[model samples]
Target: MATPLAALAADSAGDVAHLIETALTPVFMLSGVGTLLNLLNTRSARVADQIEKASDLLDTEQDKEAKRKLRHHLRRLTRRIMVLDISIMFGGLAGAMTCGAAFVLFLGSVRDASIALWLVALFGAALLSTVAALAAFLCDCFFSWDNLRKSGPLPKSVKKRSPESSASTTG
Candidate 1:
């Protein structure tokens, strides 16, 4: 009886270790999602800033062509912001589900409970949400790049020129 009990204890410890290993993948995924969220948020802030600048220009501009261009820019910026927001939301969801799955995995291991189906469902949801977030991010990037191509290259102020080059141009 003592031998059997000791063997069972060893098996349970091994099972817990396996569960921890399995949970590690989602932990890494959560970190990736966090990084992506930070990137998306930064991009969103940039788009918002562009929108503000365009709005100011639109208000003061008299030329019809210039106003039209500003309007187009504002439209594209608005769409990009929306897409980025959605992506952030989905990424957050993925992170939450991944955390839940990790918790459930540990809980099941400690309790010696069968939770394979629950684990699968949680991971599936997390993966699907992650995919949606990535898709939204891609769409946002496309919108930004397409607008840039339409508008031609960036302005001279955005381009970096060496001191010598600037002095020559001024002369």
Candidate 2:
């Protein structure tokens, strides 16, 4: 009888170990979602800065053409900010769902409950949310890249030139 009891304990321990091993993948996924959220936040800050600069220029600029350009930039910045915000939200959702899945897995294992359906549903929700977040991020990247390409090279003020007085000395 003691031998049978020991075997039962060993089997239970093995099940717990397996449950922990299975949970590890979702933990790693949570880490990945955190990384993506950080990147989205950084990009959002940059967009906010650009929006501030554009708003400032709009207030002071008298030239019609320049004002129009500034307005366009502001519009683009606003759109980019919205997209990034959505991406961050989705990423957060994914992380939360993954956490819930991990918790459910542990609970089910301890209670000896059949939670396979719940596990699958939670994991599937996490995966779909992650996919949506990534897609939004990709769209934001395209918007940023297109704007940079359209803006062309940096303005003349950023370019270095030889001083007029120094130019004569070279001869």
Candidate 3:
């Protein structure tokens, strides 16, 4: 019986080259998933920071309306965090599935056998997971944008006529 190394040696250069090329596709996809996870993590961190800041303010705030607003804002930020967590989880799953597919592909090549079933299952799952992740990310984006638009402070309007004194500035 030939050793695994010998089996590899027996493979034609073209076959090896093709295997590498095939593997590269999923590797590239894995890289994209990594980048997406990084983005999600960063956004989650920002949301956490906002929660911390809001919590701090709520602790010291004496005004009931302001405290209530801060609590509402905290709830929104918490929702954002949950959505991002979903995205990150799905993204990580996709990355793992992609890696599994690549591994199966490589092994199938060395064994010189078709891995159609495993390849399709793994790759398809990876794609589906990626779609789920994208959907979650999109939802998070929409909610966050809407929240910002709703809560955004209005720009100070330029006074067409200035007051005589500091009243204009204060007003």
Candidate 4:
């Protein structure tokens, strides 16, 4: 077995930075996609709510049919938001894995220098960015669920909740 000290050796600073840069790619791509989806969903939900409200003034069969279609579209959008949330979270995991592999490689090459310090800083920043992406994903998931719940009817049990009610009292 390779000793721990031997495993940490690196040959060059450029090599370590290359590893870090490679790890950063997937992290930024995944998180950027997630953020864009979140923005799109939020804008869509707002437009949907406005349309729904305006639709109440409409009384024709044609009007009702159009509203129904709009509602269906909104439901689909909500599901898409949820899926994006999940995808982003998985992407963050992938980013972490890539960064870990690069770090391990850096350590094994053992050519420690200013490049080593730069790689360490880069690794830390990448980890932080991945974590932020995870947080955004979770927030978006909750937002999607809340929007979906509000856009439709609630079960009687949920409807009956008093202002002071708690989950224990209901569930």
Candidate 5:
């Protein structure tokens, strides 16, 4: 009967709407998490630069107490940097999982405007999260490469320092 078929369609639409709602919450959460992680990464990079500068200043100091304080701060900063890196990686993983789940839901048999709207919104959030994750990952890699260059066996410096110079020694 037409009435029974219409009822079944309405039930199916309701189920799809529910699925979209369930998927959307996680998608938005993941997007927010990713953005926060990126912000943390940027802060960590700045802190690392400050730590390096502080280390450089300590090298020129003769005060034992000041040197010790500088070293302590530097160590703390290194630990924080490591923590930030780990957090970013975890956030990226969460974002990827959330997007994947949303994509699965999009493939379901849903026939409703509300369901479509939710699916589109979730997908957009997922895309933004993915972009943030990628940007953070690339920045991390760039910093890693810069670190390697500085610590490499032979840094390609334009001005070669003498073996006894402070520049080469501090480095």
Candidate 6:
């Protein structure tokens, strides 16, 4: 007759396989959240760069009207960064909750305990957080679009990047 350990070993393979299947959904969601976070961070960085340029222009600008315009642009850019920050925060929260849900699921499987409630709660919260992040991103898009339309074609005090500029090198 097989020992208890041997029987457990025989049964564990199917249990582990089921756990992996159940865990895949959260992993996919986490990947999407990571992608969104990447987008938000990149947009925030670009906006920050614009803010720095605008600040420099505001300092050196002699015309009253130009200074006013620079200040306005700076305000809009700041608002964009704020919205992006919100998106980033929510995206990060979603990612964390997704990871937590995965952990709970794994723990439940290993311990032979029912973690369905906790998993559902965490996954649901993650979904909500993802929705919130997307909403913030959409708001930022609207703001950016309106700002662009009002500002017209020319970008004041912002230079185009060209090859050989060598302003900042990337590996």
Top candidate (TM-score): 6
What's the TM-score of each model vs. the native?
0.79, 0.80, 0.81, 0.37, 0.51, 0.82
- The collision pairs in model 4 are 7-108, 8-107, 9-108, 9-109, 9-110, 10-109, 10-110, 10-111, 11-109
Candidate 4 residues lying further than 4 Å off, grouped into runs, are 1-114, 153-171
RMSD of each: 5.8, 5.6, 6.4, 12.4, 11.3, 6.9
Worst 10 residues of 4 by lDDT: 153-162
The worst-scoring run of ten residues by lDDT in candidate 2 lies at 152-161
* lDDT tens per residue, model 5, 38-144: 77678777867867776675666566666666666566557657755765775666577566656656554333224556555655655565566556656655655
Evaluate all candidate structures by whole-model CA lDDT and list the values in order: 0.81, 0.82, 0.85, 0.53, 0.61, 0.86
Candidate number with the higher lDDT (4 or 5)? 5
> TM-score: which is higher, 1 or 3?
3
Cand. 2 TM to true fold = 0.80
Q: Which stretches of candidate 6 lie above 4 Å from their native place?
A: 1-18, 153-171
lDDT of 3 by residue, 52-140 (tens): 88888787776777777787888888998999999999999999999999999888866867898999999999999999999999999
lDDT winner: 6
Best-to-worst order by TM-score is: 6, 3, 2, 1, 5, 4
Distance (Å) between predicted and true CA of 22, model 2? 0.6
Clashes by residue pair, model 3: none
How much is the lDDT of residue 108 in candidate 6?
A: 74
Task: State the lDDT of candidate 1 residue by residue for 58-120, as single tens digits.
Answer: 877767777777787787788889999999999999999898888887777666678889889
Question: Of models 1 and 6, which has the larger lDDT?
Answer: 6
Q: Tens-digit lDDT track for model 6 on 94-157?
A: 9999999999987876676789899999999999999999999999999999998999522465
